[model samples]
Target chain A: MKELKILAVIAALVGITYYGIEPYAHSVMHPEVSAADFTFKDAKNVDTSLAGNVENGKVLVEANCIACHAIEKAGHPALMPNADAAASYGVVPPDLSHAGRIYDKNYLANFIFDPVSAMHLSHKYPVGGTKAFPMPSYNWMTPQEIMDVVSYLQSVAPKVTEDKEGHKATFEAACGRCHSMAYAKFDATTPKDSIKAYMGATPPDLSQYIKSRGEHYLHSFINDPQVLLKNTSMPRVGLNEKAQEEVIAYMEEIGDSKKAERESLGLWVMLYTFVFAILAYLWKRKIWSEVH
Target chain B: MAEFKQADSMYEWFDQRLGIDKFVKVMMTEYWIPKNINFLWAMGVLLTVMFTLLVVSGIFLLMYYKPDINMAFDSVNYTIMQEVAYGWLFRHIHAVGASVVFLIIYIHMFTGIYYGSYKRGREMIWISGMLLFMLFSAEGFSGYMLPWGQMSYWAAYVITEIFGGIPLIGGDLVVWIRGNFYVADATLTRFFMLHVLLIPLAILGAIVFHFYALRFPHVNNEAGEFFDFDEEAEKYLAGDKKNSKVVPFWPVFLSKDFFVLGFFLLFFFYLVFFHYGFAMDPINFDKADGLKTPSHIYPEWYFLWSYEVLRGWFFEIAGISGKSLGLMAFGFANIIFLLLPWLDRSPMVKPANQRPYFKYWFWLMIADLMVLTEFGKLPPTGPNAWVGFGASLVFLILFIALPFITKAEAKKVGGK
Candidate 1:
């Protein structure tokens, strides 16, 4: 009986010690986000809030999209497919902040309402762009949700004048052959001529340019033009400082504004630390115990 | 024949009243089992109970476990989280039990060494134990991959590929085992079968033989003094002999064993309940994508010393390629234990009676193993590789030099 009691006491002590250290071991080994600080406002505009939701949209943006898009104030795109690469294959998510000013509200509405039409040049928007990316269309979204996203974009979109000069230069250099450049207006009368008239070579029609290039290709071209059309006569025009601003402004005439991506470093660190701690504790308790 | 029947009846009568008091008195008065059996002697009993737990829990898990890569992880999760009542508890206990078994076995082996349990008539036991260690390692490696998690997939890949270092047939051997260039569903299935059935069966057989051989010579008690009992004392020890305190096995050793087992089981349960399960990740929960390597890849902790040895070889010979040296060093480290029975030639097995030279070597070997295990856990970084390599060399020197040094000391002492 005495022996049994001693045994029970030892067992109890071990059990208590294990229980005490368990959370710490788990914390160090498998850190996960416990706070409601990060969430995705899905296509339905449902506010999926994380614990602490302290930074509002900031943390969510980082966790979900920052890997591909620049979100944090200091974060840069680590794997942004360049314009040439994007245009060649046509799979890319464009910068959203300045998109509201580029495309007409109606065009933006149609594209967001159905990304497939944006993805493929359908008969309705027939221009048949070469680039192809299976950009998942969010058909599940409500019109109200889409409008909320547009509103978010409109609030943060860069000022219109910041990119006017580059648009004018591009219009003069490429679109000047067939259209008038007054108030950034085009003639819309020139025939689809041979490949030798616009900028020393006749290019594809501008009316179907968005449909042909697609959102991804267009974004990449605006970001870095040389990447898309190699030795082609599409002179790398809007890529320069003044031209880039203006061209982006011109493009916004055709694109919808969207929220910038966010990057959450705190969550990643927490997770890494948790996993490390658990492994260390287990290893120490089991294998390393043999040593001491 | 009548006397035998009377003795059998007497044993049956004694069994009915089994308890600690009667058992202890009998052992003291009859069995002649050295009263000096210490903490070290308790390990054998501990190991036996631990093995029983391992086998029982393992069998329960095996009944529901699917070894195929596709179902392995899911089956484990289902068994623990949903299927059998308290299934999760059982699985975690078994998983953690493996670690505990290894822990106790290591202790058992070390204790054997400290008491010269490997010397003379004990060579067979020592050799069998070493084989058991090898089987345990194989069991661990095979079971580790069953979960098909990130660490499991990668560790299995890296460790199995060590065979590729062989001159001619290495690649083929690896491929045959894997059934593909990489470890996948087939490999998991095969390993699962081996882990759940074949290796375990072999381990059980080996353990029986180990004990059978052990009983032939009886156990080496703490005093390290070999004794020959007279017929009267032997009979008393066996409960038929007079002037011996022969305790019934039941409620005597049985009760003590249960107490120890209870303590261990409590520790095991505490880890399982509070920690949310053993540390191994459910590898199959995440889909295996070859392109994305897990951030950190390491074998389970038990294999860390050999891992460290392999890594240490990289920096040992500066001009030589790190790959070859690393392989050789790891191979050498693993096989070193196998050579132990032949290495030391001390006439005395007890630590207290062993020559100082032999003691120095024994302690150094222990230190070397500890260092290797430590080095294994660390990431291959800046000066760690060099440190591991340098330490390994020192250990190797100590290991080889110890025998010769002991022999020289013995010659000097004899001359004096």
Candidate 2:
């Protein structure tokens, strides 16, 4: 009779567990929003021709962005002094080196057209507390030109393109700025002591990252590393929803080729365990018969 | 009773050579346990399984995890989850396991409180478990910092800054804990080391001590009487006591243990797979920016009650700043478990369920904790602040009044 009572309690516990998770699973788990819509008065002309045209976008970037924003990566200092520009603007212009990995095209285009609004800037500080250093809105230049400049910025952004193919595209694009990924191609001949260091720790090799952590771990992680984990020095890479999915999809494609196969096997494991439980229960009841 | 007499030939050979037979006879097959213990006895075994799962999953996570600030979050988010094979399963197991461990611990503790398991000659056993709970809180706080999320940053700042509210050397102490002027790489490095290695070893030592402190032949039952174990053992060993009532630890309890463990596993895996986000704070999704301080900062659910107590002291008292007093109150609340043995002055050792007034007070304390925990998540203003302040006073009164309240009730019931 007592054993039956225990079993009844176990059944109730399972019901309680289901109840505990129902509300959370329903309301919080599968969040629904209208696809992060960001449209404007004139988006049609900008949206049509300049989606992925790298060539025409480069020319537009050279004409406008080259004055302050250096898009390309190079070994030496810029030929022109940028100190006067910083003093006048009150803040150094952020490098557009990995803008593609950092910012999605939608945000980049939106920011280009209206920096004050897209970046949540207040009217009190048109250029973030600098009255004279306002970012000139390219809204006057047909949205096509602004989009072309965005395309140009993304085209120049660092990407892992089969060169070693170990460090990821987004990883190389964002993290490669300060960290070295040479460890990806390290071998028997490589000198361990000669390895480059960044941020006081050996710039971690992220070659096997996707194959090792929990799924859905990266979305919030990349959105805001510090917010996801506190006191972390990792700045938000600023990927929009679509770009975030693309990066993660690329990572999953490369890192976990056998993911589908492995997850499919979980069913077999549960089935085997369920069968064993029935046998185990019968054996336990038989063994305890004498005691009662 | 001699189930091993006709064991396999290989086992007989090994037992003769290595004393395996004698060891098993002494410990496993021969060890006797009381048969009347309730369902709550399963919690200890449940806790052990949870700990083992945490360690195993933690090791897998630590393998690909980068402790560096710039690399840590990205490595966990992008590399591990996206690239690793079954990495998500392992990480979820560890993350969800941390939250579940506390739930199991609360059950284990309340069982002890309800059954009066912390009776005469078993003070050390209770103390060891309490000490382990303290260590777990530290481990949880440090591990939370590893993700470097928004809550991780602000919670760390808010909690650590409370130390700066100290009269003297508080500033120095804050820097000492952070290993810098603010939370940085150095803090993360130390937290990683402690979470992975040092603290786990200490917890393991505490578990060993807790088991050792469980005195022989007396499994403190709901009847609440401390039996004379030496006298009971002598009669049983001499074969003069026909009604031994004690059963071998192997088949009797081991089978039941496995049965209970199966249910726990089902419950645990369900959470790890489907509902892991329930324990996680949503605000933590944003990256930590030092310049931006979030409007409302809250700790994890387990720490909320204490955080509410800390926040309750909004008004200055006795010439000391409320913040400084709050720091003291928070620290004391955590350490207050140490006073449990002395605080309840009832001479009777009856199960708390039998003590009517004590039972009422016990539920009140639990309700008080529930309210404080809820208030901790809300903005500290309006009813949330004032009610939480009132609740904090009630929390103190519950502890202070326990001995007097329970003692008076015992006289009416004639329990002793």
DockQ, all models: 0.02, 0.10
Cand. 2 Cα-lDDT: 0.65
Q: What share of the true interface contacts does each candidate keep?
A: 0.00, 0.09
Q: Which whole-number lDDT from 0 to 100 does residue A152 have in model 1?
A: 44
DockQ of 2: 0.10
Q: Per-residue lDDT tens digits of candidate 2, residues B330-409? A: 77777776677666666556666577677787768767876777666667777767887887778777887887886787
Query: Candidate 1 — what's its lDDT?
Result: 0.55
Overall lDDT per candidate, in order of appearance: 0.55, 0.65
RMSD of 1: 18.2
Q: In candidate 2, residue B3 scores what lDDT?
A: 43
Looking at model 2 chain B, report the run of 10 residues with the lowest lDDT sum. Answer: B239-248
